[model samples]
Target: MKKKIWVNIAFQVGALVLALLSTTLLLLAAGAPPFQAYAAILKGAFGSAGSLETLLITWSPLLLTTAGVLITFSAGLWNIGVEGQMAMGAIFTTWMLRLLQETSLPPALTIVLGILAGIVGGALWAGLAGALKTFGGVNEIFGGLGLNFVSTALTIYLVFGPWKRPGVGSMSGTEPFDRSLWLPTLPDTELSLWSLTLSLLALVIIIVLLRGTHFGLRLKAVGKNPKSAFLMGVPTWQYSMLAFLLCGALVGLAGAIQVTGVYHRLLPNISSGYGFLGLLVSMLVNYQAVWVAPVAFFFAAVNVGSIQLQLMYKLDSSFSGVMQSLLVLLVLLGEGARQRFLRKH
Candidate 1:
């Protein structure tokens, strides 16, 4: 076991080195100094107190989304509709906030309700996908993709129609929520300590649940061999559904955090591809709960640092995305190589 662990770590480190080398080559091709660009990235991500705060803010939702992805992946489910689920969550959170923005309810209570609504919204969206897979014989991937489009359209319609800013609504999004509806942020920064705390707590809970629970073991068995697990009396279908629901709830919470803790409004692209990004994080970490947070933080830093690349090098921020894709590709290739080596030996 220890040998396997060390081998895994070595492969990851080698993959990182290769990824960086590939990214450097790309930078050179684009007429930029690779070292300088890397320096700027680090600076943008952590050079200042404000930048560090922003990094933490970005990390919060990312950690939550990735944790959710980890759960579904462990259950052998492809929950690609996390994007839609997140959008639904944001929509639900906004709906609750809009309805109660003018009420006499305490801010804390109102925010809690809004968050819960977000969770329900996400769970419902994910549940639909799970039902289609289990009962309708539809592939989760296709169903999820279709649902994602529908959710995006719905968000656009709401933003440009009934929920549009007072009048003459553009695609910008709905009007910002009342200040009182916003999540409480740390002093002198846009970072929401409440959201961050919740994210950390959720991570701890997930780690415990996945590593130390019978339900998690059953889910793993279902993923590894549903027929065998069923023969052993494990309710494979039920456990699969539970995994989907749990994933949806966490992702939905991420969406709610984005709305209340960051954007303060429901936008057409409110999800901002964090769902997809979270998928990458989950894959890179091999679904280990212990590695999710650090991987999330690294990705968040890359994302935040890309802004500096755009500003200083006049480079397209998509370069950061390229680096991310390369990292995942290299990691996958390295894993494959490691397996082949073990098989040959």
Candidate 2:
């Protein structure tokens, strides 16, 4: 067992090295100094209090999304519609805030209601995908993708039609809410302690749920073999739907934070690709809840850090994405190789 553990660690380290080596070659090809570029990223992510603040802000939503995806992944569900679910969440939150902004209710209560509405919206969207899979024989992947498109279209329509700003609607999104409705943030930063705390709490809850619960064991059984799990009397479809609802709720919180804590308004691309990114994070960690927080934070740091590459080297911020994709690909390949090696030995 110890040897196997060491082997696992070695392969992980090897994958990390390969990823960095590939990223270096790519940077060199791009006429950028690899070491300096890396240094700049490190500095940009941690160089100042402000940078750390931005990193934390980015980290919070990522934590939420990653935590959410962990649940669906465990249930053997693709849940690609997470993006749409997030959009619905933001839409619902924005709508709720707008409806109550002028009401006699306190802003704090209004914000809580908006967040709750976001959670409901996300669950409803995910429930649609789950129902299609459970009852309509539609694969979750296709159903999710289709729902994502619909959600995007709905967001566009709302931003351009009913929820349009005064005079004319622009892609910039709806008019901003009053400051009183905003989530409380640390002084001089967009990092909302409320959002951050909630995100961390969600992560902890998911970790405990997945690691120490009979539900998790059954869910894993369902994922590994649905027919077998059903034979064992597990209600596979119901569990699957429950997974979808739970995941959507968590990620919906991410969308809610994006609105109340960060953007302060509904906007196009409000999910910020965090849903897809969360998928990558889940893949990278092999859906192990324990690793989600650190991996998500690393991704967040890379994202925040890559801004320096664009500013200093005239490089596109997508360089960070390239690095991330490479990392995930190599790690997965390494895992496969390790398994093959073990079998051979």
Which numbered prediction scores highest in lDDT against the true structure?
Answer: 2
lDDT agreement with native, every candidate: 0.92, 0.93
Model 1 is weakest, by summed lDDT over 10 consecutive residues, at 166-175
Q: Residues 83-124, candidate 1, lDDT per residue (tens digit)?
A: 999999999999999898889999889999999999999999
| Candidate 1: residue 339 lDDT (0-100) | 93
Q: After TM-score superposition, what is the CA distance of residue 48 in candidate 2 from its true location, in Å?
A: 0.6
What digit string (tens of lDDT, one per residue) describes model 2 on residues 1-345?
898899999999999999999999999999999999999999999999999999999999889888888899999999999999999899999999999998899999999999999999888899999999999999999999999999899988998899999999999998999999999988877788999999999999999889899998888888889999999999999999999999999988889989998999999889988999999999999999999889998999999999999999999999989999999999999999999988795
Give candidate 1 misplaced runs (Cα > 4 Å).
1-7
